[model samples]
Target chain A: MSENIKNWLLFILTVAVVILLSYLANSIINRKAESQFAYTPQIEIGAHEPRNVVWGKNFPRQYESFMRTRDTSFATYLNGSKLRDALGEDPRLVVLWAGYGFSKDYNQPRGHAYAIEDIHNTLRTGGPTGPGTGPMPSTCWTCKSPDVPRTMAEKGIGEFYKGKWADKGSEVVNPIGCADCHNPETMSLQISRPALVEAYENMGKDIKDATHQEMRSLVCAQCHVEYYFDKNIAGQEGVPYLTFPWKYGTTVEDMEKYYDQMEFADWTHPLSKAPMLKAQHPGYELFTTGVHSQRGVSCADCHMPYQSEGGQKFTDHHIRSPLDNVANSCQVCHREESGALINDVFQRQKKIKQTQLSLEELLIRAHIEAQKAWQLGATEAQMKSILMDIRHAQWRWDYSVASHGGTFHSPVEASRIVSTATEIAQEARVKLARLLGQLGFSGEVAYPDISTKAKAQAFIGLDMDKLNDEKETFLKDLVPVWKKEAAEREAQMPIRPVSSRE
Target chain B: MRFSSLKKKLLPPPQWRRPVIILLGIGAGLAIYIAHIANVGSYLTDDPTACVNCHVMTPQFITWRHSSHREVATCNDCHVPQDNFIKKYFFKAKDGLYHSTIFTLRKEPQAIVMHEAGQEAVQSNCIRCHISQVTDPRTAAGVSNHAENRLDRTCWSCHRNVPHGRERSLSSVGFHLEPLPVATRKGSFVPAWLDAQVNHTSN
Candidate 1:
């Protein structure tokens, strides 16, 4: 080749490379700008802002999505945003919880938007006409709203958990919102609740070192996980403080060991007279054992996936079942057809449900047989081991069932838990049968007619009519007043406009 | 018309031109060959292929490939420090020596874990990238987070999946790379620059 031709080619090549470099640089700058949107604040959001309507002005997309939690149209095979009376579906729950408040009523929670409303409606919270009147402690308000953090910060964490459920009625009006899991100033995921922080401290772990991705799940863990009212916290005695029993560890057996060591009992079964343990929803603990969590999927990854609106991307706040929006939740990683994925979840759930039902049947029979033994004048010594078995079996049953979505979150673990409970229940029934035979009672101590929720409640000796009447009056009289007082307080803390200040 | 006349008056002498071109050709050829042999191109991009550059990392790579993080992050984004280039490469070299020595000695257990230094790197990187999450003014005094013990725990204490899947083992992952029930295990070691050569549509 000629030297002149070679020189020309080199010059052309250099110019081409220069052009490519500039294009690449321009795109890099553009991409950076794209990711970091020019976030012009409309208002200065306070660190403890509880009213989501105030936060809504700053982030319309997220607020809008959060507001979508109000939608009750969606339903899955078992549960969803839609309301389904849990006791109606499964009357056995009433008999299982016999002496507990859950026997009065058990309604499936609608969604986050109805947190405050649902608490007022549910019979479990009981009918309190005013402060210091309800069966539950003020700690029950811990997970219902952003108002909880605000009240806790304002009137000390311990003080916030000091009284009855009605004590903070007027103070905490807002439902679960932005502030419950976010630092309003930075909009970063923050642990607003003291219980989760205290729980971590008890376990010799710190919450601050949790990564953003971990925070995604941990925020939900704050409310969704199993917790108990510890009336024996040092220096804060008799407060019924909301506390996670993770001191021993997070496993069902580990928590059982902790409760057993402490000799804690939620309530004594009236018929069987066995000390019982009620399992609160342990969604986070069960979820941790699942395959998705092990592979680094956060709660938000599935429940609140990143959604794009127009040109902007934000985490969808309308948290509900993955089945409701299979395209966003399941199809994000799963290449399988949506139907197949839904079927897979349903299949696991159905199999777990089968074992759960078997355990419940065994438990009911054991409880009735124990009652017959008591009627036959059996001594406490005779029934001690049998009651312990009942307690153990019921704990396993409640643990398996109370871990919401246990079947899908970690199917093998959920199924394992239920099967173990079945075995325990069977063991309890076998003991009960032996005890009954010795007490001069014969085969099959006539199972109580608990076919319907009403029948179950009646058998359990719960006057639903009186309970409903009291709840109705409280809702009609006190709830409106609570709303009014909350409104007056919120009105005083108006959001200051940033642009208007200038 | 402009460059040829200007080159004649200025620039390199004709005798030196051939040697310069020859040297440039050999240098380019040698650089490309080294990069090809060392798989250096894979290191530059956010591909999992660079992770399995050593055979010991194959299990880790496969698990990560199937992870939800498979889309958002590369190996270095979590496993290496992100503060500055000097510190990053420095940390990498130091950590690499320890890693190479261990793997060379076949010291990795069935379950691989991050060393203290690696853990520090990962924790700092997590906070660095997730600055928005950790930048809570409420935690300024650390009073809310129990003051002295704020950073005593690491992210992976709860987030085991960030390192690798808890269930998957070296023996569990086969060489065939077939689709598994856990994760699809769909990814490649090919760098973005050479993507066209392999028709690499997926990242």
Candidate 2:
């Protein structure tokens, strides 16, 4: 009886150990599979594929989240993903940009999915009824789509930027998508635009040395940076070449010094006639000065944070304001409740806006003051120093505001720039007072009645009625043809299913 | 006989008493020496220079001095609790202890950002001073939370540049001599003398 009992116990213990071993082996295998980011290819993505639908077949989750860029419901205190009529909101901007194309119609940019459509619809494109009709160069399409890189590869960089913006309308039909910032094969972050590489080259640094983390922000910097159309490159004359003014540095003072030395102007202000500089979106440069960047946080760290969906971890692609998802973005690093974090951002923005608005008022007066100086028979010699001051003052103001997130990114820097601009503008007024006395008319130049967008535009002598009429015709007649042509061309490409599973 | 009696009463035997007196005297002297070296007394006053005694705070002091609030306020006014005497000293003592430990260990992070207790004091001070500006309906934090769990808003979240410039990094640590830094290194992070002393002691 004792022998039987011992045998039974031994048998049961062996069985239990075998079961536990199998369970451990199964878990190990499952974890290995998950770590591989396992996915089977649905269709082979072409090396130069620009159509997002082709990539979507293999990456449904990423593509679906990316498509949420179509949503325009979100708005914030100052800016948003909505198609906001900026000039309508603040007429003073119309006078500030006087002779620039932005003055014609400057809408705060909508979602990235609307990139191609919005550019085609804006009046600033100047009614491209047929090819080569718009005022802007083909360089305007540089940031609009992945198709730009593909087109540049085929047509060559200088030639890609040689023609009018409308000339490439049929070709750049797709809005910004996957190929703009990714390697097709490995899906690693990559810079598709040559301008960014060239800018880095000019800065005496190699873009190749950037780490995977740095590449996350560098990809966004490829488009969201201050750039100019350098028309006088040694071999690429009249190409309206895209160039970043970083030879000196990325600061306002540095870029201003570079532009002044080169005698480059975006457009001559018709009202003030000061050689003007349009501050393009310098989002990346301004952000580097903030506490976020100093703490080694990348743009994607906040803008495209990691999301786990269906047991798979990937960067969330529905990029918009951080205020929209403060829990996932700001709250990840900041322990302050969402309300506290947002209140902080709004406070900084509102405070900066107060000084910015004051700068705008001062700028309007200076322009009118200079205009008065010119009208009262002030000679070019006398107006030279005064015009330089206006240019410097206005450049500071634009640099602070045009970066869009500068107030939140680096409020101290923005505040300092605006406050200094105010001082320079007051000095311009002081010099104007002296100059006007010599010209024999010193009565305070009557402030123009620019109480509304229409009045402001009219004060700046813009023919908004004609511009709107042309825009209507362009959108109704030409845009559809371009879209249809692009669709037909894309449909011809073949996408075969790969018979392999990873 | 009188002289011998006076000597016996006034002074103890040299062997044991001398050493005992010496040990207690050394202990008290060392305590006062540390107190003087740490500039502990300055922390009790409203002087901004007391902060820069730690070289890590040089940048914040320089930035504050150049700010618009330089004429009006000092570091303690915004950072220290001001409800009453007891709470104020208690908070300072706790904070100073933590800071000294971190600095001595060379374990401070690059950013040197504030934590909960520091944040609470600053928030209360901001609301106290700028009550009118904060109470404005347009900028005020409303009672509604939209189902989101969060604490109420603080002023510095918006007014980031108040008295101190926005920088909070070790890289911003300037080498200003005035106000007399308690500790300064000329070459590497650990001064040559300190490195030599450490090696000698370890050996």
Which candidate's TM-score is highest? 1
lDDT values of the candidates? Answer: 0.77, 0.78
Runs in model 2 lying further than 4 Å from the true structure: A1-38, A500-502, B1-203
Error of 2 at A140 (Å): 0.3
lDDT of 2 by residue, B1-203 (tens): 99999999667567769765875576566556556656679988888877766656656775665444654567887888988989888999899889866765558786678899999998888767776765665544564551232236666776775656566565553223234211121111221222222111100
* Cα shift from native, residue A210, model 2 (Å): 0.9
Show the lowest summed lDDT stretch of 10 residues, model 2 chain A: A31-40
For candidate 2, give the lDDT of residue A212.
Answer: 56
Judge the docking of candidate 1 as incorrect, acceptable, medium or high.
Answer: incorrect
Q: Which runs of model 1 end up more than 4 angstroms from their true locations?
A: A1-37, A500-502, B1-203
Per-candidate alpha-carbon RMSD to the true structure? 18.9, 20.3
Please, what are the lDDT tens digits per residue for candidate 1 over residues B1-203? Answer: 99999988665788888877875676566556544544556665545566665555656665665455665777888888887888878877787667745654557686676678887887888877776655665665556663334467776667664536555444544332222211222112111211222111110
Strongest candidate by lDDT: 2
What count of clashes does model 2 give? 2
lDDT of 1: 0.77
The deviation in Å at residue A343 for candidate 2 is 0.4
